[model samples]
Target chain A: MQTVAHAVIAAAGLGSRLGLGRPKCLVEVAGKPILEYQFDLLAQVPDVRLVVGYMEHEVIDTAFQLRRDITIVRNPAFRTTTTQQSYWLGGLHIEEPCLYLDGDIIFERRTFQTFLSCAEANAPLIGITEAKTEQAVFVAAEPDPRTGFLAVTGFSRTDRSLWEWANIACLPAGLLKENGGDVFTRLSRHLPLRAQPVECFEVDTEADLELAKAYVTRLHGAGTQVAAA
Target chain B: MKPNTAFCFDLDGTVTRREVLPIIAAELGLAEEIGFLTQMTIKGQIPFEMSFRLRCRLLAEIDVATVAKIVEQVPVDPAIAAFLGEHREQCFLVTGNLDVWIARLAARLGCRVFSSTAVVRSDGRLGPLTSVLRKSTPIRELRGQYDRVVVIGEGQNDMPMFEEADIGVAYGGVHAPAREVIENSEYVVAKGETLCRLLLTL
Candidate 1:
């Protein structure tokens, strides 16, 4: 049986790049809140905990209005921290495999569905999108010609290069618990873990939001519902 | 903070399970005018106040007695009624609606009502109120007075007040809050009874 997993959403950061006075999660792309779109999909699966920091009231109000069953945790250090810290704050009380989502990104529902399906199947999958050179943390991958297994070398931090931005991930509880607070402090240490990739979207900047809006317009034009990866 | 406390609620989705404005307008046979404004509000093309004023003018052709009759057809949540009745002294209704039939509603719920109104002349034609209270004003005032204030609502208009409250609850009905509010609220509840239950428990 695939036990229902809990989801931890890191919505602590004020996405300044988006230039929307409020948190990025509050920004509306389509008619729905981006965070709700994330929660709505996760709500269908099972248990979820939303970790909120800046603009916590707005996020909790909406989530609670959507479904009172959602557990909300506060992160006081959101302003001075990275997403890794936000993840750790929510990760502290979690058990079983949990899904972690970046509150800003919006993607197709199938992307998240695939992540859940993979998690259910015991496959650790990481959602990935092509990032430009400027937007990438370049890590070299050796695609084995025979076995087709891509072996990752050491991590190389890049600047201004578009690469895969991992929007969502199905992480086992052990990954969170074992790492503890150091998870954000030590993500650079784990180069091999960035193996599997899925459809990923980034909403880090105003340009990204406009791109997403246009993307959504096109997707809806083709009669598709926007889902998160 | 001297336990600053005030009960602020939205009329349509928060107290009732649906949007009462459209229902009331429809009942008064001004469905077309009200419906158009409502559609515009939902589409984010116009602020709620503009839409509300236009609807009230359309319904103004009808008598207050007819509005009361229509209000009778509107369903209110029993638990919400009980909550308001019990907390009448502390509760205050803050809505974007004109006071077409709010007098009866105020008497029934036994809570103070704060709404915009279209003034009726001696001849029974209506004119606008001195000033309309935007959704956040009540919350801002309540927050200033009380150490604690909570606003329960379900819609885009509720977003500003949702930001002002110490505890903000998004009620799911005709429209849910923007996804951002949901993610940030202290609690999110669907029905009025469930919301009342949670409030009492807290």
Candidate 2:
């Protein structure tokens, strides 16, 4: 069982790029909202918070139906803020290690479970994936001598790398700053963080949504193989 | 420096387990009629102040002693009651509920009350509306006394305080907050124990 007590989903973005005129978490991938998959995976986390702003009632209503126990932290300033700020607000007053992630993600169950195990084992861990988004923040990494597992060295949008940030991390609440520009930018300040492979798909744009559909289809087709390799 | 924060709470459906108005209406067998209006007001179809005025008029015929007796029995979350009791000096009940109807409930909760004031008539029934609280007045006053004022509520009427206070927490322990309240709030908490835990830490 994961020891982390809190999980916060930063779902307050306008997702203007997707142009659905709704919160991205409400955008259905196959037949369900992106939040359902996240809720299913977060069964063990005792405290869950969704930072909602853009079209929040839809998210809150859906949350009431899907998972009612989780807390709903509102970020009314979605128009002017980024995910970093939303995560900060959601994680506010949370003193323990928190599992923080983007709302628009579909992570393979087994891979995500492994990532959770690693999260508890490592302090201030970052989730990485196989460099596969449309506008990927490529992660530069090298093998850790102790475990031979990849550890993030640096992050860049222009630089090419084998792995990218999966928009997930298990971090102390104090590490997240109010003015933290982007989640990645804030994480960049404390570099050389431990990295663990978590097979996931992020839906950001119209094109990426199609790729996510394929990713979900792959997950359905093969239970174990479609996940972290 | 962390400011001396004051925790101001709304009464109906927030501290009290149910909406006090509808419960009072039940005394006169207008529960269904007033309950429908309450639901409508919560959904933002009927305006809160207008609905409140109309409900108060409908309920004005009931004896003030009887209304007080009914509200005295309304269930409250013990965890929240304990939280208020522990911080009575820094806590307040800022409600749009009439003082005559909910004053006893507020006193029981150990909160310095800021509610719409009213008086008993010659016949022992509540008189015409004396004042309808704007809800923001007390929050504005508290801001002068404290570095940060935190507002906790779950209704449409609570939006003014949410906007005025330094920090707004939409409490959904009893019911999901009005959409406008959530929009104005900086944080929305779902459970009373969790809310208390958060308040203790903050």
Off-target runs (Cα >4 Å) in candidate 1 are A1-229, B1-3, B123-125
Q: What lDDT does candidate 2 reach at residue A69?
A: 70
Candidate 1 local lDDT, B74-94, one digit each (tens) = 678888889889877678888
Task: Give DockQ per model, in order.
Answer: 0.05, 0.50
Q: Could you tell me how far off, in angstroms, the CA of residue A199 lies in candidate 2 after the best superposition?
A: 0.8
For all candidates in order, the CA lDDT equals: 0.66, 0.84
Per lDDT, the best of the predicted structures is: 2
Query: Which pairs, if any, clash in model 2?
Result: none
- Determine the C-alpha RMSD for candidate 1 after optimal superposition of all C-alphas: 11.0
Question: In model 1, what is the error at residue A2, expressed in angstroms?
Answer: 28
